[model samples]
Target: MPEDARKRARRRLSIARGHLDSIVRMLDDPEVYCVDVLRQIKAVQGALSGAGDVVLRGHLEAHVATSAGRGDSVELVEEVMEALRYR
Candidate 1:
């Protein structure tokens, strides 16, 4: 993985962790605002989405591109297809 991508993933994960902790605390409080909880959930989802994007970008740039350059991208394409089948 690229250093920059790794850093971004780490940052996103950190934010996700904080969001999860807040959610846990909110669960203990009877008067927690629903909007605040929803906002935190959205923040966590966005962070996770960003991390997924980083992983996909790295896979495309390093694995898929290299496989294509070597004229043997079939396996990579097949793997992606199989993964997408469940979606």
Candidate 2:
């Protein structure tokens, strides 16, 4: 991956990790409302999704297209599709 894309993705993942840590803390707090906790969980999900998008974009731009000339592009594309489908 390009340095910029990798840095951006890492930042996103770090945000998600912090959000997840908050969720765990909320779970342990007796005063936390269910709706508020759920909202935080959704936020974390969105952050993670954003990170995934960054990684996918980087893979397509930096690897898949470059692999086309080497004859492994189709396999890589299929792998990406399968991963998306399962996710």
- Per-prediction TM-score: 0.84, 0.84
Model 2 ranges off by over 4 Å: none
Q: Distance from true position, residue 36, model 2, in Å?
A: 0.6
lDDT of 2 at 7: 94
Kindly list the per-residue Cα lDDT of model 2 for residues 1-87, writing each as its tens digit.
788889999999899999999999999999999999999999999998898888878877887878879889789988788768744
Task: Report model 2's TM-score to 2 decimal places.
Answer: 0.84
What is candidate 1's lDDT per residue for 1-87, written digit by digit as tens?
Answer: 677878888888888899989998997999999999999899888888877777667766777878967988999998767745543
lDDT of 1: 0.82
Lowest summed lDDT window (length 10), candidate 2: 78-87
Tell how far residue 23 is off in model 2, in angstroms.
1.3
lDDT of 2 at 58: 85
